[model samples]
Target chain A: MSAVMAESCLTRNEWICGEYLRTRSEELTDATVEHVTITLVAIALALLVAFPLALLARRWRLAAGPILSLTTVLYTVPSLAMYALLLPVFGISVSVVVCGLVLYSLTILVRNIMTGLDSVPDEAREAARGMGYGCARLLFGVELPLALPSLMAGVRIATVSAVSLTTVGAIVDHGGLGNLIYTGMDSYFKAQVLTASVLCVLLAIAADVLLLGAQRLLTPWTRAGRRAGRRRTAGIPRDSVMDAPGTVV
Target chain B: MGVLPDTWTWLTTAEHWSGDGGVWARLSEHLYLTGVCLALACAIALPLAMWLGHGGGRRFGGALAINISNAGRAVPTFAVLVLLSLGPLGDHGDLPTIVALVLFAVPPLLTNAYVGLSEADKDVVEAARGMGMSRRQLLARVEVPLAFPLIMTGVRTAAVQVVATATLAALAAGGGLGRIITAGFATYDTAQVVAGAVVVAVLALLVEGVLALAQRLFDPGHHRRRALAAAPATAVPARTAP
Candidate 1:
């Protein structure tokens, strides 16, 4: 589209141009940083909030119905709607994006947390009781460790989703790569749009793979149990529960 | 509270419901885009995934197809829509958006269809085969029926996601209810933005509820599942959150 067409891919506005990277290195780096920061912060906040909510649901069965339903309904709200719903209170800030993500993450995080807690075999609790371990010790030492795989799996799903969702934040002027992608699309900046999008995807995959490795490292016994060939997955944490209703919206 | 009353007024105003950017037009656009993408996705994914699930899963081609579909889910819909609209397909109105959305919607259907059939009862499949049923007959009479519930679930999930993403896609030169919200933003019409969001949310939930009803009504073993759910001996205590 430009007069300097003979220069190279940059002049040609090619989608796969490498010059976009050379010219926009700092810009890409800044967006990537913001994206990663928001994603990690949202997930951490969600985990902090969801664990107690899950425990509350477990401890008080009466509250379980309402707590679970509320989150599920929240999940059903589209992210765009969720953000728009939140913007009134947060006043068009990054908090709106983060809060929206945390709310969205709750349905999965809370459900998975409860599932992990529920899956702790009664016999293990009994054995811990037999050992004279106190309630706190029992929860932290036995229960949480046993539930690590499920909890980690939930975090993995939540993180990947958060990365995808952070792109939607661009509408609010904070969506890391999303900002680049949207602006690029406006002027038909092919290289910028493609590069930013590819970067966004790579970010999600990287987050997922990182979490998977962390799950393995933390739940070593899952691997050990599998290796020992004891009942073929009875003792192992099934992080393979990919039945997560991946609303990539 | 400030935004709420204005939003109510915005929604209540008949003028807001009939114009170019009105709720009716944007909504019809949203639904039209959603329906077309869903139909295309199902057309491309269901039969292939089902076939792979029935008799081809162990082969490399089948696995490759399944993996590719699953991998497609990781690409953000916003990015896809933007790039697609800006690409060679730019001049074709709604074509780029439809292509992006259809690509977006396929993965869930494929995975669900394939997984559902693969999970068909091996014992029941064998019994059907022993009764001298041909492979095609066994897949049709046994496997497909068994997997019907899950396939329906896949459809529900996909529809809901498409609706939500379509709303966002409108921000990046795409169309739908999202356009109303984006337009509201452009004009600093807070009430319109909030009202538009409310309508989109309601639409998403409506689609979800209707599909869930369909899943329940159309499932082949819906009665059996209901019976089992009612049976005390086999009944589980707590609900499994999706």
Candidate 2:
């Protein structure tokens, strides 16, 4: 298939079928996997840092402002410049790419985590405390669960941004789908470019859909509300269990 | 010891400021290119956003717009430049570069416009309708004015983004401040690169400041305040109905 595609690419002035197939089958799969892995690692690192910082920020408002502002400044620094600055210190390796990616993720992740923590209803915390729940137990059992949806939304945004920005890594001789894009540009191969572009879009959409589904699954109470509403409108007898608003604890 | 040629030499040289390759001449071309691209983006995105915001259609279209914008945000400016240059439009002067920048500029403009128009006070829109204003009139007279501030935020963002991204036009052999950056990169001239980066950043800041002023000036609430303060002094009845 690769040989055939190479032949067709040579013969055709426009993008050829075999070349498209070969590029997608041979080059794209490995590159996309690598990109996805790198992005996921970066997001994981961001979450590790951001979640604790968010908890700290919640405890200390003054700290949150400066930290968030610093992240915002980092966000404005252009992607290429960030990569260029890092290259000298970290070299053109996955470490530098990950550093840039993690730094970029901080702005989104911190905002998301802080908002999630702030949004946890005060009444829920009071009820949990009334039930004699400890801080660690309350946070894990109540607050984090309640804030999961918002936190996931932030993760969704961060993940998509990471996926896109990782393409800049291609400039530093790193291998990824961005390599295909850069190659297509350098060689003026439209099919290669379009195929890679389409793949990136698809990857973003797929990731979003999966995250959304996970959010829905983790927050069954929201779904339960819709179901209960439907049952009430249909004149079904509401069970006392369903009638009671579940306490956070 | 020096990075490259002196900055003043490049700036003051008459030959460098003349004809096709002159610095001033190139700057003018860059401005024209940037202006045309931004105008085209705003023109296309503004109406689309207004219509979408007005709830003329299902949100599926809005979702599509959001997705496309996200994609646009994801793709690096240089990557887009290269793709456009190679596809259909090859490195042929300003057209491809403009197209790329327009793509870059459109998303934020469209998203903000749609959000702003849609979020305008429903009561005000209803009042405008009660006054027997047509849909077009309501949009033109009420919605657009009210939404202008938020729309300007999008425009401000797009301006900064376009100006910064426009520097990539140099990669396509299109003349712009990017030419200096790319040239500097090629010749290993750190000063030239720094100069280009400085000028582009300054231009971005200036554009941002102008847009910020425009936002402040067009804020409907600001006008309302002035009107309230001036009301007692004027003999004419203030028109505050709708």
Candidate 3:
């Protein structure tokens, strides 16, 4: 252990070390692009599949149980193990990484979309139906809009987790920031590892924050309702209000 | 499949299970890494989350802690492991890996425990307080007990995650089942890699199953629900509210 420490410490001392100068910014940029591509593609595919599945589950309550259980089981499979399992079929390709990531995102996405759809107020549905709105029209116009907040939260979670999980795909050379980390580990390049790891974390945070902003921008009423909720629940204590129905936060 | 027989041969061979880098040794190392990190995380997170849930109120600090931990979920485990292992914390054997895994484990454990306690029926809590229970008593006897299922769920989630992730320890020169997979990759031995993955998958499933069973056993309310569902006559109660 001491030898290990001595080697690394000698390799890259702190207190404003010049290790950062050793890293290639252009390589970091390329890695960032790859990371974003993998994350976006996986999330998009998961969302596409999840929306329809969520609708089906919402349409049939019994189906919801089985579908959710299946997804949860899939979700429990470790990222590395899943990737390894897929290796036999996909053979270290981008498809394997994206497929594994999409599977991971599905449970969260489907559950959230279903819950969001469930949370659409009944009176709004009644109003839509009374106005001769067809099921499809109501879902597109009324139900989906109201479900935006929860759906956005789910998307934020799915996207961020996808970004993180993409790092694991580096083992297969999926061309992401993980590649940097892997190569760094192989060569014992401390600068390369630190740069890549920090960038991955930063990218995740940036994506999460961006999604949060987008959710706020899209759902004005949620923010308004939250303020109104705060005013109405002012007299009550904190924990009690937390349990209140329809409390956004 | 072509891979299965080869994987079986690799798994069953005594050579694969014997030696410093063998499955048994590696599995023990993996378990040790998981066990230590998980214990450390639970010790730190459980009480803090429970306290925050039971009495810390809805302060900004508590909310901030939960939010930061949730964001921790977004940070890739591999990246953290790599960074820690190559940085100042590097070369400390499994210390870097444990730190990374512990950070990863804390978010779910903390969130679930807090959310579970908060979601415990308010009416039940009121009743407990009405029965002359002190604040501590109310938390311990009523809230924590009520929150057992979700808390156990958190533990199960964290345990499975830790077990699966402990594989990365090999990348940092720390011992674990991951070494088998990595070595297989190095040698282009698909069977060994597949076998290592199978072992990990099975380990994760075992942890999940054990924790789930423990949750059900510890939480009498879950048993009561099972009993109620099992007996149809008792379930409906033979009475009409109408």
Candidate 4:
């Protein structure tokens, strides 16, 4: 509270204080690492669960409605509600947040994965079958590769969303930078609040750019001039990702 | 006490339904905040995006606006909520929550509204122009009407999100059903928290359903054909260079 200290934005608790960033770099880094870890794990988990579920929906046809409806319902659930609903099962661990994110993301992932599979040309599937390819071979070799663009699109949305939602995990004490944010909120620490939130946004945008790059690498045929097999045209535009309740259509 | 029956009892209790802290009070607060935020978002985003989409140097400027708004999606709702509440814009009260939610809601509105307007059947737009319709006439008579569904989709999307995240307003001393959840968290009352979650989820889904129904019922898609069921831009013969 000295005059000299008050002259600094950090001691004055002002936002945009570079001093806070310098002094709290370690804490910030740790929170960021935790945030990134939670996001990666949730996206990976959701993909694992979603592929089987998407296949089931595609296979049974009848199961498709219920699977989609359930995921959409899950998407509609507020993050707070979703977290609370899971706390009983996961019991105050980061898993509760991860579980909630995975469920929340299912709507987007399953829909995109389904769309990807459907976009695979019947001729390709028929040709694979004509060549004596079995169901697994057709799915693994022919359909999935063709479905890459859409699937990658789904992953990008789900990943961005997971990054954003991970902050809410702070309520339970595991929210990485979310912890700093909430603590800052409680204490009215302007620098912590502003810094943590900016980092979270930067993290989300960075994840999105990274995924877009990954999509390009994975599906090189989709490179600019070719534009042959990218099949994201059916539902709502994919341009608006993050926090969107996927294709309510 | 949060076992199924306990939550049932908690919901049924008169005490939980009728005070400043009651479900009814908080629900209204939540709804009021949601209503105001959605209206503000629509007012700001729809006009600006539509103008940009219609003609305002729509090629470069429109894309820039759309890209900027789309980038807006990367900003987390919670962070904005907390930042506004705790940062320079607000020290306390609903100002932060309102500002944050409006900002959170604008991007979808902008993206959808612009897409809806710009992507309105190009033929219909041209026909309207051919008929000597002024730009205003074409936009109002042809474009806005055509874009209604997508525009409303934006509204619905924004509304559901506001309902879901408005609960976070509780963190900022703003009133909303989120208070119910936070209060339960504060007290470690499992049943109360469970009840709050159930209500918020129901509200969000209900908003989504109602809006979907409205979009279906109200969209006057009179002259607009789905246009050869045009598959996305993928099939459109590449635009010949000017």
Which candidate number has the best lDDT? 1
Interface RMSD of 3: 6.4
Task: State the weakest 10-residue window (summed lDDT) of model 4 chain A.
Answer: A240-249
| Runs with alpha carbons beyond 4 Å of true place in candidate 3 | A1-23, A232-249, B55-61, B223-242
Compare the candidates by DockQ and give the number of the best one: 1
Residue B21's lDDT in candidate 4: 87
Query: Can you tell me the DockQ of model 3?
Result: 0.38
lDDT of 3 at B207: 80
- Assess candidate 1 and give its TM-score to the true structure: 0.93
Order the candidate numbers by DockQ, best to worst: 1, 4, 3, 2
Residues B49-136, candidate 3, lDDT per residue (tens digit)? 8777777555543564457555766667786777778777876767898888888888768877887787789999999999999999
Compared with the true structure, what per-residue lDDT tens digits does model 2 show for residues B1-242?
A: 33334644555556645687556665676678778888999999988887788757536545655555566655656657767888667746667888888888887787677767776899999999999999899989999988887688778777767775676566556677667655655675555554555555556556767878988987877778778887766666643211
Candidate 2 structure quality by residue, lDDT tens digits, A106-215: 87777776666767888898899999999899989999998886788778777777777776667565636777877787777777776776677677678877887998
Candidate 1: which stretches are off by over 4 Å?
Answer: A1-8, A228-243, B61-70, B228-242
> Model 2, residue B88: displacement in angstroms?
1.6
Q: Native contacts retained by model 2, as a fraction?
A: 0.15
lDDT of 4 by residue, A1-249 (tens): 587677888777787898899889999999999999999998998999999999999888899999998888888788888887776666779998888888877888898898888888888888999999998998899999999988987887788778888888877888888899889988989899888989988898899899989888888776864554356433334534432463210
Each prediction's DockQ?
Answer: 0.56, 0.16, 0.38, 0.39
Which portions of model 2 miss their true places by more than 4 Å? Answer: A1-7, A23-26, A226-249, B1-32, B55-79, B168-206, B223-242
Rank by lDDT, highest first.
1, 4, 3, 2
Candidate 4, clashing residue pairs?
Answer: A170-A175
